[model samples]
Target: MSVLNETYTLSNGVTIPKVGFGTWQIPNGDAAYDAVTTALKTGYTHIDTAYAYGNEESVGKAIKDSGIERDKVFVTSKLPGEIKDAEEARRHFVETLANLGTDYLDLYLIHAPWPWNRIGTRHDEGNLEVWKVLEEQYRAGRIRAIGVSNFDVHDLTNILDNAEVKPMVNQIQYYVGFTEPTIVDFSQKNGMLIEAYSPLATGDLLHNSQVQGMAAKYGVSVAQVALRFCLDNGVLPLPKATSEAHIVTNAELNFTIDPEDQEALRHLSDSAPEHFHNSTQG
Candidate 1:
């Protein structure tokens, strides 16, 4: 019973795979191509990428070359977040489709509340404008689901309070150490599914002795423990890996962690031994 066979129902009734193959820093050419191709061959039914990742073309090409039915794989991408205007939002959405060579997307997200360099500047009204564009595309059937990423409660509230359609997903920088209680609770409570980006904390969690101990108890790797931790918390994890071993092993979540140990992991004093915590990045 590998978890790769499992799926989660979104707020709008669209089903996405529980595990997602992430292509964040994988680069555009062979790196992204090979990783996405390997993930598909290894039975990954979900793929998450973004305009900021700058690898949608390669990711899409890999999926096309994999010989898998387009609809069989759940695909997700995001708007660059800086484009707060409706016109630019529409333009980027079209560009994303062209880059992926797909007419529609399983899911689409606003990459962030504000641009990367302008993190603290919450463009609430601008975000609302973009959200409305997303709502337009979603209603037109170009995107099966619409959502946001890296959104705190305040940013998400802008959409939830005024939009005709609420966000269906919120992709955040979640890991064992940073549970992001406020945003996660608000999103889930509002019927949005949480997708965890950097679930392994960019390889930081691989060295946590506490997590390692739990992995040892389960006879799995530290990555497996981290991935399962997200699932246990009702968050879908998007793990990025390039090697075939890692791409395959990442989704081989066949065993369940003990309830007691899970609680211990959730409340760990440190999630990754000084490497990763809430202050690291989001």
Candidate 2:
């Protein structure tokens, strides 16, 4: 069986595939449809999209046309960053459900604690309000799991202090050189999973000499090394791929990284040239 068949159980007992296909920066219509279809055909069971990605409708169409049973494929979408009120969140949730053509989502997340352009703005009360709506929908069975992306400890603590249900996952910018040990530990200790987005650092890490050296040593693609690093460290990785070969290669994680190599990867500093901030610039 493909390694895609492997899974990680969430806090609430929902089973999420260990490797997920990410749909960030993928335009809607044919591009999104084709990319998603390729991933599904290549054996990826988890699909991560967001309202911010502007491709949920196309992602949904591809999934519907693939003839895969809905239950077998775990679908995830996120609320827009701008939605900070309970009513607005409910409205967007329904719209997302309609756009995806799914009655329920396997997972849904608050795209960010603050709006994209205003990353550090205080939104604790606003997030709490929106989380209330998510809690309501989750209880009504409209979503199987609910979470937050880009949330640090303060943001996560706000929800934990006031909400009835705690977040099941915290999706963030995580990879071999950019791992946030503090957040990872906090999430795991509190029964939440950390879903690593940009596992390739948006393609910058692929060219790092250190990463390339490790990949060459292991006889795997640099992408595989980065992703396997996350899995070995107990974080789920969501790697975006648009090509069929890459989609297939991203899931072939049957090898292990030596303990010492894993430690070196874990200790790679955020100040390193290949870190997330340096590579994400336009």
Q: For every model shown, what is its TM-score relative to the native structure?
A: 0.96, 0.96
The local distance difference test score of each candidate is 0.90, 0.89
Model 2 lDDT per residue over 7-67, tens place: 9999999999999999999999999999999999989989999998999999999999999
Query: lDDT tens digits, residues 243-282, model 1?
Result: 8999999998888898999889878865755553433134
**Can you list the residue pairs that collide in candidate 1?**
none
Q: Over 4 Å off in model 2, which ranges? A: 270-282
Q: Where is model 1 more than 4 Å wrong at Cα?
A: 273-282
